[model samples]
Target: MKLSLVIPCYNESANLPLLLDRCMALDSGSDIEVILVDNGSTDKSLEVLSKLLPRYSNCRTVRVETNQGYGFGILSGLRAARGDIMGWTHADMQTDPQDARKGLELFDRHGDGIFVKGRRYGRPIMDVVFTVGMSAFETLLLARSMWDINAQPTMFSRRFFETWQSPPHDFSLDLYAYYQAKIHGLKVHRFPVRFGERAHGVSHWNVNWAAKWKFIRRTVDFSLQLKKSMMVVNI
Candidate 1:
């Protein structure tokens, strides 16, 4: 089965060449296509992509003229994907884009009735603690054991994706997809992946406590709404 991996780029101009190099190894094969999304980047990202994309046959670009949220960019790529198996990873190069290959293997062995994600290692102690705290909160609050909620290379079959009713259009999209997999009884598979430093540019969030608090506030609000929706579904 063909696999499509979407990497959403938002002003990731410096990271593009390195990211594409890493992707070149995976995208060389026709079975795996890499979709590099220019998610309304104000920098020279589109120009860089234009010059670079033609060199790789298995990779292509999708342009979103207006920068929407992270999830909107991913959704844009996903909607344009041509693979039977589809998923997304980060463009920051913090998480290796090649890791998606392992996710593809999970589908090859387990079949399409599963959801696959990475479990990050090699993060700083505070980041790990933060992740653990958030994991606990989401698990307890949503009644689903959601760990490493924002880890990269989240993969599933197109059929599983088609079942999504209204996936979020922000970072919470990670939580939304993971929770959906749990509630839908998809066999969850986890693989270890190294979480490294960004190749370039500061994070849009996660810069400091204030940024993290905003992320948390947004996530908690979405989680509550998701919980209420689940309750309604049960009713």
Candidate 2:
């Protein structure tokens, strides 16, 4: 089966080369395609991608003229992808690009009608604590296994994706996909992967505690809205 993976870029100009290099190093046979998304980067990212993408035959670019949300960029790529299986990772390079291939390997064990995501390791102690806290909170609030809800290499079959109804257009897209998988009775798989530091540039959200708090508050609001919507559908 063909697999397509989207990497959403948002002003990640510096990281693009290494990210593309890591991706190109993978065996880019006809069965694999990489979709590099320009998510309204103000940096020279689009220019860089224009120059670099031609080097990889199996890679292509999708441009979003304005920066929306992370999910928006991913969704744009997903809508444009041409693969039997589709998923996404980040541009920050915190997780290796090979994780997509690893995630797709789950199809060997569980078949195509399953969802796979990374279970991150090797994060800083505080980050781990924060992730655990958030996971626990989401589990209690949303009543599902919400661990690693934002983890990369979240792969699922194209058939499963067509089932998405009103998927959110923000970071909550991960939560939306997770809950949708559970609600629709898809087999959920998680693989342990090493999480490393960013290859370049600072985080847009992790700039400071205030930024983190804003992210948390926005997520909570999204969670509440998602909970209400799921209840409405009896999902």
Candidate 3:
């Protein structure tokens, strides 16, 4: 099956070269195409991709002129993807591209009725704690067993993706997808993957406690809205 992986990039020029190198080194023979979405980057990202396109056969790009949100960028690339299986991961290189390849392999075994994601390891303790707390909160709030909500290489078949109505345009996209997987009775399968420091540049939100607080507030607001929407659909 052809698998398309979307990397949502926002000012990730400093990290793209090495990221593309790692992605290209992956030998997944299932016609793996890496769609790098330029999420309104003002940096030299587009130019770098232009120069590097000839180096890899599986590399392509989708440009978003206005910076919307993390989910919006991936959605833009997903809409443009030409693969039977579609997935998305971060551009910061925290999660290895090989892990995404591994996620693709799971499709063969699990079939099209499963949703795959990485269960991250090797992150800082505080970050891990934050993720665990957020996951727990979402599980209870949404009445679904949510875990690793921000995990990478989230994947599903084209069949599953077509059922989405109005997905969020924010980081809450992760939450939306995972919850929808449970809501639709899809098997939520997760594989262990090591999380590492970014190859270049610091995190956009995971910097400090204050930033984490802001992220938490934003996410909680989105989660509430999503739950309300789901309730309306059920009614």
Residue-level lDDT of model 2, residues 1-235, one tens digit each, is 3898988999999999999888886655688788999999999998999998888888899999999999999999999999899999988999998888888779867789888999999988887887888899999998888897888888999999998987877888988888889988888999998899998989888777798788789889989997898789885
Clashes of each: 0, 0, 0
Give the per-residue Cα lDDT of candidate 1 at 127.
92
Looking at model 2, report the run of 10 residues with the lowest lDDT sum.
23-32
Per-residue lDDT of model 1, residues 83-162, tens digit only: 99999999998899999988988988999999999999999998999999999999999988999999988999999999
Where is model 2 more than 4 Å wrong at Cα? none
lDDT of 3: 0.89
- Compared with the true structure, the alpha-carbon lDDT of candidate 2 equals 0.88
TM-score ranking, high to low: 1, 2, 3
RMSD of 1: 0.9
Model 3, C-alpha of 44: deviation from truth (Å):
0.7
Q: How close is candidate 2 to the true structure, as a TM-score?
A: 0.96
